[model samples]
Target: MSKVPANEDFYKVHLLNEWSWKLTTPLDAQPHTIDGNHIFEVIFEGNNTDTVCANDGHVELKFAISAMEQRNPRMPRLKFVRGLSTQFEFAMASLHTNFIRGRFGLQLLFVSNESVIPGEDFRLESLFSINDEVTPGIFEMVNIKLGERDNSTTSTLKSHSNTPQSSWPTGFIQARPVCYTSERYREVKASRDAKLSKQRTVLNTSDQELLLPRTLPYLFYAQRIKPTDDPHEVVGMRLQNISFGTPGDGYYAHSSFIVWTISFGFGEPPIDTLSPLLIGLITLSAVVVLGSLLFGTMLILIFQRRYRFGEFQRLTETDTTSAVST
Candidate 1:
């Protein structure tokens, strides 16, 4: 296992063998934008090593695997894809976007040439804080939450028993949501009262019908509010309330709108969908370039052979003319 980086900014995260994703929107006509160009770098050290890494350049991996897991979950086994250190980058893009409905969902696709290990799915809850400030809900924002397992022991075992050996840990982690409303703006603010404090309405009314992720059980969101005279005006007075976390089989799996995406990959050739789509696009582009080179080489060879034959005929004709003159 690699030592945890000393810098506080380098947070530890857990990646499961499975992949999951989600996207949410505002309740009304709130402004919103989503860019899924995030990257996940997985470094593997093990007995069978065949990985790719670099001191400065981007490390290219043949196949990568990742999944949503609670706290820093344990990965007891890892395979090296190349002789060098293995690193990877995953990209994000979507088929479409919706403003009126205030809802968006992420699609999951994985590709890998390596075998995968079993693991748990969880949210990275440890990063959420109560002291973070607030921002007015005028538009929407989207961010990624990297998860780390709370304990290494809380993972799947390689036993013959069909039943689970132990229960999963307590919490899940989540990234902050984009809140747009009538009032102020504060970044990275956490609130204890996610629902009652200053909850932002989901932009899409239709999305109010969907369910949350099955792995996340709790629901926590923040809001910015201005006190008013009427007690019942809590919904109107608050500037923003952004939803964050939910427990497994809880309100999240039952929520109408949720915004998040998961990227993962597996081990082996003919990479599985488990490989991220962003990566797939890159591999496809490479194949096209190689094909073009092969075709161009064949055309050049044919033209060269024809020119040589024509030159040989001209030489023969000149030789015959000289012989006739003599």
Candidate 2:
């Protein structure tokens, strides 16, 4: 048997990042059906070849809901299950009592224990992976605004400190690792210990905290689903507002990579409707056109008045000259 080339290996690993999934509800079909017992199915299909290997690799699925009473829970309700093999179903009846008329955020995350080996590096880049691409923040203190807080009270805070304490952004809750095997767990422990051992000096409490590593357990892929045309539909309820990424962070450091939005409760996926961004663009174009017309009319009036005034001055000069000659 011939050994696979490096390029071929890279291609195989790249396929793992190319996987995608979709959400379909009964409301999506023709003659839409939506009730209290409605079910939302996620169809995940992807090519996973043998060349892509991780020690304890698996995928996870999560669904987050936001509505009136429980609006903006610190952490979303999560479901961890084997991903990319088959269709997964979530019965709305099991999760909610009456019917949840709110926005749904569906996320898929990939977790693996393949990075513990020292000197043996695994390429961390993925379509869904979120990490700093350039130099990390240079400043010790960064000023940020938390939700609805007075701008005057906003203060400069440290990004990461060597102290015993740390501050997370608003609405962010700490989470523990969810999926892993015993062997992987041991390896992670060993690797963490080895890394910490190198820093032997007993420095200040802040210095110790600064030496700690920030570990992101999962890399995510996400989508937002909004309500459909029908008001009675159980799925695709109206969304007040939806947002992706973390506040003050340029990218979604802990959140999922948002792909796009999907609509349900309609017969067919309606044409990608105009977005608020598009509407704003159209309004701006109209304003510019009207402003240009008004400016042009004003310029024309000014030019006409100047021409008449010059003609009157010329006529007055000619009359004065004739009088002088007489």
Candidate 3:
């Protein structure tokens, strides 16, 4: 197929660096790690083949992860997936997320791409499947106020993170990868490993606590959702400094590519400005009310001044003096 000429028809998510994913079969017992001999490179954009993807009049971005699996790490521009020229659409139609609109969907599918050899140089297998259900955080518009604190019907996890969600500006969303599970453990695993997963991280986000009468029962944290230039533009997410383990945390502390789901806050972008017609109407109403009050007050004061000055003459006094002669 000819290359789709690069244009603004879609947005490209550029990464700071190349990231890789490795899996160990029988990860608990006899371990054999398969690095896949490929660096992961993916592109994202709105699925606009049929018209711009939209939802309830707002633009909905259905970004698909097109993984360009390469056999040689040095061949950065190599575009090959399962021996095909095009990259595999790993998680396109199925955008998996748990928290948004109090609903969730299984928007992901991946089966092992068997290598020519079983353990050595294994290439990951993939299938592009759809589940018909609307994928959570797949560019759905949300309009919840800062604390939706009165949201009892919302899930317990709707407010589970340590970030001050109440202070999260409008159009901010956490495209949290709810969970990563493998029917067979030989491939994918949870991004968070043994220690960090269980680690009780309690950030001191007492800024809101200062506004409260007393302390709140919540931990404080940051970086739960990545910030954006257009806070109300309803953007998805991309990560920098990707790694399996940090120099401090050591290797296997985390999996870089597992949680790389690019979903955005599902909500209505803020309507900061009122319509011009509405504003004009409001100004007119205010002027009319003020004018009526001022006019009434002036009339009342004038009447009081005349009456106090004894300016009222009786009707019988209006008769002319010539009436005496008649």
Highest lDDT: which candidate?
3
| lDDT of every model, 2 decimals | 0.26, 0.25, 0.27
Tens digits of per-residue lDDT, candidate 3, 158-259, equal 334487544433321122222222212212233222111211111122422332122121121222222324322211111111112223322321221222
TM-score of 3: 0.21
- How many residue pairs collide in each prediction? 78, 5, 8
State every prediction's TM-score relative to the real structure: 0.21, 0.25, 0.21
Candidate 2 vs 3: which has more TM-score: 2
Residues 105-138 of candidate 2 have per-residue lDDT tens digits of: 2222212111111122112111211211111211
Between candidates 1 and 2, name the one with more favorable TM-score: 2
lDDT of 1 by residue, 107-209 (tens): 2211111111223222122223222112222122121111222223433223234745333112111222431111122222311112211212221222211
